[model samples]
Target: MTNVLLDAHLNAKLADFAGSSLDGSPLLVVVTKSHRRPGDTCCVEADISAFASTLYTIVTGQSPYHDLSDYKIDERFVHGSFPQTDSLGPLGKLISRCWRDEYPDSKSVCKEIQGMC
Candidate 1:
């Protein structure tokens, strides 16, 4: 069991570094608006956005702006344009809040998710 977990961890690290999933799908690294700016320090908002984006990808099997180039995606994110989430139901709403920086911190996001479950 330890070996299994270690292998999974190593595979995930490799996939992250390689910019693709083990299955060869492109891996999207979620970057928030603040993260795109020069000299901006990492914050809880970034963490929240990342978590939401990752959840979005897991549920949808693709990144929010999977069809766009990195430059285009960054530009859209800077301009506050995010992928539609209506079909995602409750999860979609949560993703929207994270993207919009509505939550105070990552803990609130977790609390909401726990409440959902």
Candidate 2:
């Protein structure tokens, strides 16, 4: 449908996924082919959005970029223009910083999350 509708759906899905406590591990680790953290990429938004998107996938069993088929998904990622879902709620804002290259490393991200919870 519309971009707004897709974003709303993704946000709802993110909330569902990120809102609950994990069964065992407090933090989830994601590894990508490129050694750098997704957010480590030049485009801060792509990295941050990648982390959020991963959480969205875990919770919703769908791709956060599912809506954009016409454009090369990779291009969208490189430009850091992907739509963000509100599923992480407040956490989403914190993680957004990661995308923006605010935090120095994952350790900082962890510390921030721990402080938040």
Candidate 3:
């Protein structure tokens, strides 16, 4: 069996070196696999970035435009870059704001999503 503490320690070390929690840096996709439940969908649209982020988590089990590069997962979160994913469906436009800086901040992004919803 895997030592849970060891696993957590390793993950923490990796995150510390990878700048996963750094500000002004790309949001990292910490979780390797999608944690969303089957048929899970995000429909909550609010004027709060936290809420928007929550909604995004519900849909993809990831932060908006996550990096995930350290884990050998490529999310392609380059500046002014956006990838096409069918999972987002109608939420694509709203999530695009994270890549394109469409919103001044997360709050604005949430507002945009709320409008779309």
> Whose TM-score is greatest here?
1
lDDT winner: 1
The models' CA-based lDDT, in order, is 0.65, 0.49, 0.40
Q: Residue by residue across 46-93, what tens digits does model 3's lDDT show?
A: 123233344465567555446544322232332323344346876765
The list of candidate 3 runs beyond 4 A from truth reads 1-57, 61-75, 79-81
- Each prediction's TM-score versus the true structure: 0.67, 0.46, 0.36
Ranking by lDDT: 1, 2, 3
lDDT of 2 by residue, 13-96 (tens): 223233223354342543332212333334434345456556555555566566655345555656755446456676766645
Candidate 3 lDDT score at position 16: 29
Off by over 4 Å in 1: 1-41
Name the candidate, 1 or 3, with the larger lDDT value.
1
Tell me which of candidates 1 and 3 scores higher on TM-score.
Answer: 1
